[model samples]
Target: MSDKRRAFESPADLARPITQPVLRRPAATTMGAVLVVLRVLAGVWWLLALTFSWNDVLLDDLGLGDEPDFQALGNDVKEAISSGILNTVLIVGGIVLVIELLFALLVFRGVNWARVVVMVFATLSIIGSFVGWWLGGQEITVHTTLVTLALDILVLLALSSQGARAYARRPRERRARGSVA
Candidate 1:
């Protein structure tokens, strides 16, 4: 047998770093940044909403105070339960924000699956917003609605741009090339 080893059997070949192709388009970079910013803004919005509305909306207005079993409980016990519930909500919300931020980062890295996920999330958010407006029976503020809609639209537009599409496609093309060879 020949002393020469096959390229695939070489340790160096296996250890070689696979470099990601750089995104050359400005639009792709901008879209990635915008998606991340949108996620950050969403996290901030949730924080503010929870901070401002937790006590009044959750405990008082929602009649957490008036639950028949809660009525018989001592004030200290009631306060503890309410505090526990609020803490749980905050923790869960924080987890969600973190997850959203991670997904945003993935999108920024030109992952096509991340782009699809973000698009799906944006579409769901838009649909949920409309459904809430119609079924919630609460007055919807124009400013909030407009801002939400604008962000969703902009995200969709940016991700759908030709430059962004090309950036996302690069990895798939690379994979195909490797597989063919």
Candidate 2:
């Protein structure tokens, strides 16, 4: 009778060196890529919130509320100042998010450089957030920044795993099927 499945491998076969690279992507790599995507989404969510209701968050911006002149300014002037600040933040922040997305795409494709970039940046961001909170008394609220911070930490961990690193560093397979690939 013909069998579709091959018999179990012998010890010699198992000990033989691997000539071909694996085609399957590791779970760690895929998870890291997905985490980065989610992190970018969190940034977009807050950016949109700030863009639309910036007036609410600007009451204490740069201590402008403490300025007698700023307080005395008409509602129109106050709104313009708030809008400017929010627009600046959104413009710069959006650019950063887009860059993150590009690297994430490469990571999903098993690119080692992109994985390194994502992990390094995530580490730096986590360190910076703690430094800001410690030195600058930056608030760490559970609603927004904390959630993103957790994601950053998770991304760093996922991309740094051995499975993810090995998958990224493995030899790339040639696309042409007829030749020795």
User: Candidate 2 has which clashing residue pairs, if any?
Assistant: none
Residue 83 in model 2: lDDT: 78
Give the root-mean-square deviation of each candidate in angstroms. Answer: 13.1, 8.7
Where in model 1 is the C-alpha error above 4 Å?
1-23, 142-146, 171-181
TM-score of each: 0.70, 0.76
Evaluate model 2: give its lDDT.
Answer: 0.83
> Which pairs clash (backbone N, Cα, C closer than 3 Å) in model 1?
none
Model 1, span 1-181: residue lDDT tens: 8976454445564344445654474575467657657766866786678667777766676797668887898989977887888788778878877777777777777777787787788788778888877898644564356566667767877876645755765644435554756
Q: State how far residue 9 of model 1 sits from its true place (Å).
A: 44
lDDT tens digits by residue: candidate 2, 61-166: 5667688989999999887887788889989999999999999999999988899889889889899889989998888887647988999999987997756866
